[model samples]
Target: MAGFHLPLYRTNLIRSSSSPAPSAYTKPTVVTQNLSYWNSIYSDIESHLKKVIPIRDPVSIFEPMHHLTFAPPRTTAPALCVAACEAVGGNREDAIVAASAIHLMHATIYTHDHLLLTDRVGREPESEIPHRFGTNIELLIADGIMPFGFELLAGSAGDNSEKILKVIVEITGAIGSQEMVAGEDGGVGRPAGLLHGCGAACGAIIGGGNVEEIDRLKRFGLYVGKIQGLLSEKSKNEGCEMELLETWRALALKELEYFDSRKVEQISSIVGV
Candidate 1:
């Protein structure tokens, strides 16, 4: 797999040494710090995932697995896990391995979903994986990757056995037959909500959050998931969508009331409300 890289921090950091700085020219320390923080999280996740899913002797199988897993960093599931951990005052290192596991599960789901789309030839031609690789092999690869995700969590648990075990159980339940898979068939509403809520709750547990805090964070994730589902629905009415988004956003913020202001801001930034 190619080396991992973070998206460039957009703000320019350079300053002219000779020029007298104006009052308005305050340094973007906060933005810089935030960028650096997330960059480290992304890097850690990539490094750990690469270690768990390495390129090796089985050229065909590993190659496709690598391609799907190491594609462009489009999803925020891993970052959300890291953010949730930090929200509850856990160190990034504690959550990094679990976050990678979450990402692998996500990739597995997507790979399997894409393969299961029977009408891809007609409806999603551009989105189809290369046909040269047989569908059965792809399915097997997806199935195989799922176990490796759990293996990563188990191996990385170290001294935090109880916490990591809880995370594994939570993640497994979230992506199991009743939740994520159900969503694939019935569309997003309750399934998506449950899945994200489960993820956030697991992250909170791994991060050592109190029972109440974990519940609150789970509610926050559920609301965020609902918003996502609503937005994705083609039949959604604009007025109703806005109302639902606002309602969920408010509820999520209410849950963050007890958290530190900095942490609340970071969570809000991740939720984009």
Candidate 2:
């Protein structure tokens, strides 16, 4: 496999007693490199997202969406989507669009979550206009952003209608009221697990994986998501959180046993195992 390497140039100066020293160039040094497939995919997805969601009119709503979507520097969702696709032997390009959609979906959900929190905690003293606008307007913006995510999926689908449709269904269900929103009501369930698992499974489908492979990857995603949720819960005891994270990480690794070691390592990197 190809690796990432950086070239270092060196210049040597030779002193002459009778005249000015002449400069001599030495051979460039090359360091052994290991390329990260996930990083490459992330760069592609970032570029694609920027093009897909450019700034538009009605700056009040779109600006907030853009800020929430890009400002934080998204890494997990898009990386997982692309990694899952590659893990299942699918081209990374096949899942880039879906990855972008996944990111937008998360942004929309986060916007809604922020609005809900702001409603209870009251807006910050120096909050943006969208935050000051309160829940109703934010809701409208969320609603508007949601459809654009689907539209991106539709546009990226090209002639592969069935695969894209499956991805859409999986993602929509994961982010719907039953899963992610369930946490809003103070539920104990790990909604992040469902969301990540669903995203991986959808990416697997997009990558043309067989049913068995997709199922395995979905389980892997579930465990990874569970870890994420546990880590995010500040109220949870640190000892218990570490225990659960280890358990889930083990389970996630088990699911990827059939894949190549390199691929497994890449997935492990994403899961932070």
Candidate 3:
């Protein structure tokens, strides 16, 4: 749910293509009818996720109690993407596969994030987080979970292994210092936005798209990050200093509004609405 994305329209990010204008949004086309293909990919993603994630204590790693409001809205995003793709005559199979992979990737990232924090705060020694030599569980949970996320994304995405590996290498390398510096310096500044953008860039690649695809993915990623920021702040309000709460809320809303606006713009372009 954190943000980092590439622009679909940003040619510099990828080798440009003169591929025919993407099929009309209303054209009746099944780019791929292999429902089985989608299902198989879903199974592959899910199985890999299970292996990496600590399923036994899902809340600690999955949807931890701290992120209640984020779950529903975040879950809706990919569904919206699927519908948008269907309207655009894009293959539902590919769309679903992308959605499944993206969502799984998000979850995987979140799980590692939690582990990193717990380890940081010394809340969960087994987490093996480098910092937080001696802190409480609450403190550990308070931190963001993005670093572990990219690692999992790179290691697990087996379908388009080569492309996934490249994206992982790039995203992971860029995000690492950003995360550590922000954490140590108390500068969670723009984390959600930065994360959202990365998500867009990386997700587009995983979905077999070029720069134009990345643009759409970036907007989508920003929206997700904003939503997460809002909900996470809401969940952490009681524990946060009163002065910080409003600041966090403001950041969340700002991120949300920015993405919401972008979502409209991108969807209009995609659907020719």
Candidate 4:
């Protein structure tokens, strides 16, 4: 199997299937190397995002789009995408578009969540949660990026054209499904679960996994996401017992047992992050 790697050169939103993307990889032999591996993935994602959501005309619109996408602490959705792909013995490039799309959409969802919070908070400052730009402008930026996600995702799939099409369907349905619509009313608890499940499934599919492999990884993501949800006070207030975090964590690791040691090791690290 190919070792985990990150593509070095910049790639456009769209790439021809005939041309293979270039990457460099080394065996994961030390903790520092592991950190470097993850760091490289984050850097590559940010670099691609710069190209994807560039500073363009209409600064009012593009500026916040850039801020929303790039400014805050990065989320794990994009990392999960790339990690899942590599865990399944696929190139990181196979998952870049879907990864970026997941991050953009998730960021917008956070924007929506923040807007709802501000409505109730009534101009008062909140302690946590990265809030920036005016609520109105944030909403407009969210709307602007919503459709851009589709454009960025559609037809931008690499060699995994058919698989990426399937990923698009998975993502589109996941984002609009009842869970997501209801998730809007609450915190990221439910929505993050959906994102994790969808992110893992899309990565596996694009990585050329078979039905069973994809299903295993999807289940893996769901359990990990539940752990994330349970970590938040909002989700705990919603009746998730803190004890269940261990249970979910155990269940998540159990799912990894279905795969070989290397895949399980890498995936477990991703979930840990």
Candidate 5:
């Protein structure tokens, strides 16, 4: 749901033959240095996810949660979160907890989206959204993951309580009051845009970004989110115009124009410029 992902895009952060592969937005490249950067973030998030959703007695329910959390295609969201933190001068530690929470939130959203996908074709040989889990089990997985995301946030609350509180509001607001629990919208609309923006904003908040800086990154993320939405539509053969994607990309980069390009060098590279 989050916008043009810096971690995801920047990790392409793997450059491209042209600007970048549209698929770049979906997942990171393996055969690449930033690959290590992204993997480190993934490893940290995975650890937090394990601690928060430890495999318990039934194993049935918990296993799927872990599977979904670590499953591919993986996410660009956590990397973007940490990048936003770094872009604002916060280290990875400052944002790891929130990154983990955001990771789980997206996992639930992804599961919910697959649930809503008709025929559940593509990406799976069996033509099932999730070949392993039943629809009923998926419902459980969808419902289970998001709260644990919040648990990561709430559990990490401390001296940063005020900042964490704002981050809470940002994330929940993006997920939508009902969408978080019901998975109603599937985050295919403006909520998706907000999710991307929320991700950057949360990182900025945790990283101690000033009001102006946070707003700048938030808008940058929103533009990226819009591009992400259109690209998803285009991939499904929905006929999205390429011009719009370029426009959003331009606007996102423009937001960083006045700032020290050095800070956002990786993020700016998202477009492969």
Candidate 6:
């Protein structure tokens, strides 16, 4: 028998094959090096976005607005981002298109969130969430360089845009309902309950009802809510309310891993893997 090696990545990689007899590997043996691939991918896409959108102003909201559309650079190190890029294994340009769309869509929601917050609490016109969030949006949109996310999906996105648009519409509707709005509304201090509810809905969308995914995202949202609740205590020593936001990156990665694995497993099983 040949000696077996452990799976190098943190998640499990299962393979099933049928050939008169069956073959199974407890883990996969693969290694990768250098973050250059993902960096180039993101950079190339960024370049394209710049060409199309073109930056005009310095104190603009476009730049920060762009950040809202994709996973913040803060979530993953260059290396990890590169690894994810490698795993995607698709047309280089298409990757950028998808990623860019993701960023834009996310930013749109953030813009709305700020608007809601601004309206809820009569903060000085400048002290509103819209003002703060708008600043970032301007910076993102006014970039001299193209955003990478636009390139991720590119021309290949097909009907995905429609689906994404639908999701945004639904989320927006939910926010408009009285149920989703509460508290100061403008500042970071939303009613803890509303935040948690929104977070749970987000988890459902991102987690896709997978048990592990749901568990992780729920915990992520719950912890975030707990932290917010603690901070809002406003009396004694309040603790951190940023836990959910802090863990969101980790949860997102995990959710994607589980979602992909389940998909692969389903495919394998259908083929009698």
TM-score of each: 0.74, 0.74, 0.38, 0.75, 0.76, 0.34
Writing each residue's lDDT as its tens digit, candidate 2 over 1-273 gives 244342211101111112222323322234222235545766798798888667787777667666666643242665678888888778888888888888778767666656654335433433442454566776676677778889988887778999988998888788776563444655533256676787788888999988988889889888867766664442233333455656776788889987887765665555543
Worst 10 residues of 4 by lDDT: 8-17
Candidate achieving the largest lDDT = 5
Q: Tens-digit lDDT track for model 5 on 1-273?
A: 113333223341122222344553344322222444445666776776677777786899888887877653555566677778888998888898998888787778767666644554443443444447776887788697888888778888888889999989988887875543333644333255677788788888999999988999888877767766665556556464767767887899898885788898765554434
Q: Give the TM-score of candidate 1.
A: 0.74
Better of 1 and 3 by TM-score: 1
lDDT of each: 0.65, 0.66, 0.40, 0.66, 0.69, 0.35
lDDT of 4 by residue, 12-58 (tens): 11122123343233221121114345556777777888988888988
**Candidates 3 and 4 compared by TM-score, better number:** 4
> How close to the true structure is residue 90 of candidate 5, measured as C-alpha lDDT?
89
Q: How close is candidate 5 to the true structure, as a TM-score?
A: 0.76
Superior candidate under lDDT, 2 versus 6: 2
Q: What is the C-alpha RMSD of each candidate to the true structure, in Å?
A: 8.8, 12.2, 15.0, 10.0, 6.5, 14.2
- Is candidate 4 or 5 superior in lDDT? 5
Given candidate 5, what's the lDDT at residue 76? 58
**Least lDDT summed over 10 consecutive residues: which range in candidate 3?**
8-17
- Model 3 lDDT per residue over 1-273, tens place: 111122212111112222324323222211212223223433443444345444355565444423411221233233333433433334444444444444543443444445444225533464443333233443344343344444555455567577667566535542455454455655442255444445445545555555555555555545544444543454434232434434543443342343345433333221111
Task: Tell me the lDDT of model 3 at 90.
Answer: 45
The CA lDDT at 78 in model 5 is: 66
